[model samples]
Target: EPEVTQTPSHQVTQMGQEVILRCVPISNHLYFYWYRQILGQKVEFLVSFYNNEISEKSEIFDDQFSVERPDGSNFTLKIRSTKLEDSAMYFCASSEGQGSHQPQHFGDGTRLSIL
Candidate 1:
């Protein structure tokens, strides 16, 4: 089975600093996404990328956040001017199709803690 993998299982950053979270999605997957779950909160959708462009995004994914396919094997989320509220478990997910019914494979996630 294919799997999505995220680097730096845990990350600590000071407020106002910039942090980049990285992920490697399943090779065969065509769609990629980023989601975050704050402590004691539900998993919230951040952004979705396809065809080398952002396909969809949630309000939580403000200008401070950006996603990129820097290379063939990597997808990254850069949080500029990080804030304390940004602390969360950021998960990378991938799917073969864009349909809502398609199952998404998720990574273990990078635990981001803003100090």
Candidate 2:
């Protein structure tokens, strides 16, 4: 079965620095999304991309955050300025279609540590 894959399983960066989390979803998936889980906190949705544009985004996806599919297969999340509170496990997911009915497959995630 196909699955989502993320690179650089772990990343360490200083506060105020920039970081990019990368992922590659199942080849046939059409919707891609980014989510993060802070230690002891619930998983929060960041943004979803479809048809080469942003389909939906949560408030957490402020100006400081952005997502892109630069090579048609890879989806990336760029955080312009990292903060201590930004430390979390960022997960990349993809689904064949939209809505709650469609199952979203997740990657192992990139654990980001902001110092």
Candidate 3:
């Protein structure tokens, strides 16, 4: 079966630096999303993109963050200025729009560490 894939399972960066986390969402899926999990916190939704624009976004998606579908299969998230609080597991997810209740499948995640 196809699955979402993220690169650099672990990433380390200093606060205030820039980082781009990459993902390859499952092919044939139409809805894509990004979520984060702080060490002991709930999985929080960041943003959801479809039809080449944002469909939904949470307050956590501030000026420091951005996302893009640079190609047919690749989706990317960029943090223009990272902060210590930004440290977390970044997950990429996708789902088919056959139904509103369709469940999303997630990648293993990219663990981002800020120094």
Candidate 4:
């Protein structure tokens, strides 16, 4: 089966630096999303993209953040300026359809560390 893959299972960065997390979404999926989880917090949705445009985004998705589908299979998240609070487990998820009822498959995660 096709599965999402994320690079650098763990990332360590200094505050005010930049970080670009990479993900390869499952082939044949239409909607892609990015979610994050603080060490002991609930999963939070950052943004969702489809058809080369942003479909929905949360307040957490501020100007410092951006996402792109560089190619047919690669999806990337760029944190233009990182902060200590940005430390968390970043998950890359995808769904088959556009409805909330559709289940999303998530990658293990990329643990971003900012000091």
Candidate 5:
């Protein structure tokens, strides 16, 4: 079965620092997305990328956040300036097609800790 893979399952960083979370979704998937969940809070959508461009984004994806697929395989989320509020489990997801009808597969997630 195909599955998403995330690197550095856990990361620790200081406030004001930068952090990058990485993931590799199923090879045949066409749509990729980033989402995050603060402790005790519901998951929030961050951004979605497709066809090499941003297809959708939530307000949570601000100037401090960015996403990229630099190698055609690995998808990355970069937080330019980390804050205490940024401590959360970031999830990477992918699907064969876009829209709510398609099943989106998610990675285990990367827990980001800010000091």
Candidate 6:
């Protein structure tokens, strides 16, 4: 089955370092999203992208964070300056349609570690 794919299943970064997490969403899905789950917390939305633009982003997705689709096939999340609190499992998800009605396909996730 077609599914989202994320690179470097495990990432380790020093505090104040930058990291780029990559993902290739399901073949034909139109809506793409990024979410992260801290060690003991629920998954939280980071940002959503559609039609080459960011549709929405949460406060946690501040200046230090960014999202992009450079080649029309891969979606990326960049953290310019990572902190201890940024350590988490970052997930990539895609859906054919929008909102709650659409079922999103998620990748296994990239585990980010900050030290």
Q: Could you give candidate 3's per-residue lDDT for residues 1-115 as a string of tens digits?
A: 8889999899999999999999999898999999999999999999999999999999999999999999998999999999999999999999987566999999999999999
| Candidate 6 segments whose C-alpha is farther than 4 A from its true place | 98-100
lDDT of 4 by residue, 5-82 (tens): 999899999999989999998898999999999999999999999999999999999999999999999999999989
Off by over 4 Å in 3: none
TM-score per candidate, chains pooled: 0.97, 0.96, 0.97, 0.96, 0.96, 0.96
**Per-residue alpha-carbon lDDT of model 1 for 1-115, expressed as tens digits?**
7789999999999999999999999998889999999989999999999999999999999999999999998999999999999999999999986688889899999999999
Off by over 4 Å in 5: none
lDDT per residue (tens digit) for residues 1-115 in model 2: 8889998899999999999999999999999999999999999999999999999999999999999999979999999999999999999999996676898899999999999
Error of 2 at 55 (Å): 0.6
Tell me the lDDT of model 3 at 99: 62
Q: What local distance difference test score does each model get?
A: 0.95, 0.95, 0.96, 0.94, 0.94, 0.95
Q: Superposing every Cα of model 1 onto the true structure, what RMSD results? A: 0.8
Give, for candidate 6, the lowest lDDT window spanning 10 residues.
96-105
- Candidate 1: C-alpha lDDT: 0.95
Candidate 5 worst ten-residue window by lDDT:
96-105
Model 2 clash count equals 0
Off by over 4 Å in 2: none
- lDDT for 75 (candidate 5): 95
* lDDT string, candidate 5, 2-114, tens digits: 89999789999999999999999999999999999999999999999999889999988999998899997999999999999999999999999657799889999999999
